[model samples]
Target: MSAQTIKGLTYPYPEPPGKGEWIEMARGVYWLQMALPMALDHINLYAIEDDDGWWVVDTGMKWGDTQERWKLLIEGPMAGKPLKGVVCTHMHPDHIGQAGWLCREYNAALYMSFGEYFTARALTQEDHAGADWRVIEHFTSAGVPFEQVQQMGRKFRGFGAIVEPMPGSYTRLTDGDSLAIGGRQWRVITGSGHSPEHVCLYSDEDKLILSGDQIIPRITSNVSVMPQEPEGNPLKRWLESLAYFIEQTHPDTLVMPAHNTPFYGIHTRLKALIDHHRGHLAAIEDACREPKSAVELFPVLFAREIGKDQLAIALGESIAHLHYLYAEGRLERQRDEQGVLRYRSVDPDHCPYAPADLTDEDVPMEV
Candidate 1:
């Protein structure tokens, strides 16, 4: 990928790390890139040097090549010293997929937020029978065709396929916790919406932030309401989390994110993400001038085509926008005779709940 330059942010690395090579990002911090077979083809992992060993963050999915790459890393640049610990940013497979394997291999402690850890455990438990109707039911309720629901159900991806069996328990990394690594203290900053209690590490001494998926330079992290929490307002939580970051961090902090090249201008990026979602919420409200199902708002909410692979996530995000508007009183939701959920604009002239005049610092707390 080409180098990314924003207002005050600069991506020093023009290209990402190759198959078995790692890039030295700073004095003691190393960057590793792992392959993923998806629209987003890669994830960035970090290694912070410590007195005993290196502190690793964000393992890639449980793919065979990824395992091979890990082995190579162990014998190559990371020789002699062992892993001090493994810190996962969230419950997503690409972030914690190989946590079990890495921790077991290096005898390192797995550190993550409780919400992410428990949620991952719940999803990885495949003992339950039958197809998981959580997603199917969610789509069905959104006015999706019955045949489409069945098709999606048959191809529905689960946690086990991507994430390995998690360890029985993990060392919890709470918000405001300080982790001492390589003679520097990295404070844990937790955020919600992308995933519950996602951990982002910040070091004032180093002038850097390890932003997992909470802040990505290229794409906005998916902030959709999942079936697990049907009424969950993830968009609101996401906006609040962004507000927190903008309030707490500076504009020049170098961000080492999970997906794109590490860059500066964190406040700028955070505002962009917040603005992007607010724009979506506005589009959804306008599209709901007439009663419309979540699926019907896709064209207005998303710029590209919603293919089979992207349908589930796209629908969830669309529903999240609708739910946020409904909660904000900008839209009214009702169940049609067909049992499909429909949303209509509550008031065109007066939208008391609409998040207007949404300056980065002035975002409503209710958002």
Candidate 2:
């Protein structure tokens, strides 16, 4: 496939590897692809051949066919490489779903951040026969009809359904932790907003990074406020994470993302992600001219029609943007008579996404 360039970023690999196939990114690093049932149809997995064995990064969901595929992969593309360990970027089911089965199959240890491991472990044990009241209340407060909310509560599912049982112990990976694998030294860098302590592996010598969901080339990772933490400002932390990447990463460094094709121009991609969210925040703030429920502003923030399947996430992202503007003092929130929470612009003249201070050159003229 011929690579295409857009927006100052270069996609060196124009097309992703086909199912059950692998692409060698470097001498000992390989990219693997798997199918997903979600709106995003595929995920990219990475494998690094090390001295002892091969370490797999981010296992796909625990589908019924996954085990057979892994078996075939071991004998074929993996070259019968003995498994080293599984490195999970976060607690998300799509990333860590097969970690346990893979580790047990290879008798390898599990590597994850403490927060991710513990949080995932707890989720695996939850029995949500009915949805948690907090979750129902959180959605209701955003103007979701009681009937729809009740229906959600009835068919609630927990993480355990998709995830295999976790191993009893794990090796914790924190920010700045250096790991030796496949002759490359990978430094673990942790970021938040998508999930707690999302891990991104960086090889400074090779000028490459396994960016996980933190720096995907196309879609911006979802930064949400969970039902448990409704008042949190995850967008603030998300923006800061992007700023850090833009400042710290070199423009030429290659980015291997979890869901998109590998590419270069890390600086440009990171800034573009920031600008995308900035646009969302500004539009949402302006839409709050009159008091509006989070559900009501969905039209301003999202382009597609949201159905029942998308309700939870739709509400989450809406509240995430709303919370950011509210915390910035550009929007004020209150509860209506129906107990639905609504937000309105606090200062009509204020720009929610503007820089904190304006220099003389930035002052507006009658252009």
Candidate 3:
């Protein structure tokens, strides 16, 4: 890709809220503010004027405070026009929490990739709120102490607050599908690991991409292996997804992410993220020269001052890295009778392991 492709793409602070004031990115694209209680702080929800009406991308959390904010924006700025539909980039609570309310209130259709929809339903379905006891058993069998497993069970119930119920029906989008919004054709580019079948929209006409959490300008999106997918090596899939995205999208595309500022250099950012994970993998491999439990490796992967919520994300991320390393033969995994997975490094020369060599061609261009 030529460097010129990324030129003229500028990052501007989103327009300030003035009752119903809206900032235009393209001719009809606008961003609405949403509240988040985290160091990351806020999520930017985009609205695109469609032939039918308005289409919204990503909803904020389902808290009453955020719902009230949406009510104000809808009643004021978008009061007259019909909201045609809602499209979620992924299944995270910050991205899909308000979906049910919007669909019910406006009678709008909801769209999401099939995988994400299934995963979202599985997660938010009542009676499925808590952690899987089998997952704790797996960890304990692998050698984690029973006390730590009990602590994890106690903390797992909190996830319910973030993930609200999803709408029963949704329009499924696949790779290569094109949707028109604001008179522009936005092509769906599917990615994985962060969330199953996460779709990032790209418009070649203006070189603009609604990157979702796929390609954030500031921090790398979290790639984790949770209890539900214990054998998953999400780090490997996430890195491959980044590389695939850079190769397919124009280098100069203006990336409007779900969070953080819009910026240039999508390829450069992808490179940085890949390097970041490689470094993390290497660090963990070195640490594993001596046997270490997931808890012991936690501080090495994240800073000590992390908040409880962040620590939870960090824990999953660390486990993902370990899983990837173990899969590649750089680390060895063992399970004790109690069922916890333990890890230690293996000599490269003696170990029967090979990393999967993935190239741009290996990545699917569409869902």
List, residue by residue over 155-270, the lDDT tens digit for candidate 3: 55433466556788999998889998878999999998898889988898999888888987555677877767777888888988988997779888878888766677787777
Q: Write the per-residue lDDT of candidate 2 for residues 197-240, one digit (tens) a residue.
A: 88889988988899888987666677777776778888888888
Residue-wise lDDT of candidate 1 within 1-367, one digit each (tens)?
A: 1013345566888699898988988778889989988867889999898988988999999975988988898888889999879999998888888999999888889999999999888877743333466656677789888787776544454568778789887999999999999988999999999888999988877778889989887677787877777788999899999999987777778889998788877888887677777766766777688999988977776656678777777777888888888888788888888778999997755643333322222211111
Number of the predicted model whose lDDT against the real structure is largest:
1
User: Which 10 residues in a row give candidate 2 its minimum summed lDDT?
Assistant: 358-367
Model 3 error, position 5 (Å): 22
**Distance (Å) between predicted and true CA of 303, model 1?**
0.8
Worst 10 residues of 1 by lDDT: 358-367
- Model 2 TM-score? 0.92
TM-score of 1: 0.92
At residue 75, give the lDDT of candidate 3. 84
**Model 1, runs deviating above 4 Å:** 1-6, 127-135, 155-157, 351-367
lDDT of each: 0.80, 0.79, 0.73
- Please give the distance, in angstroms, between residue 113's alpha carbon in candidate 2 and its true position after superposition: 0.7
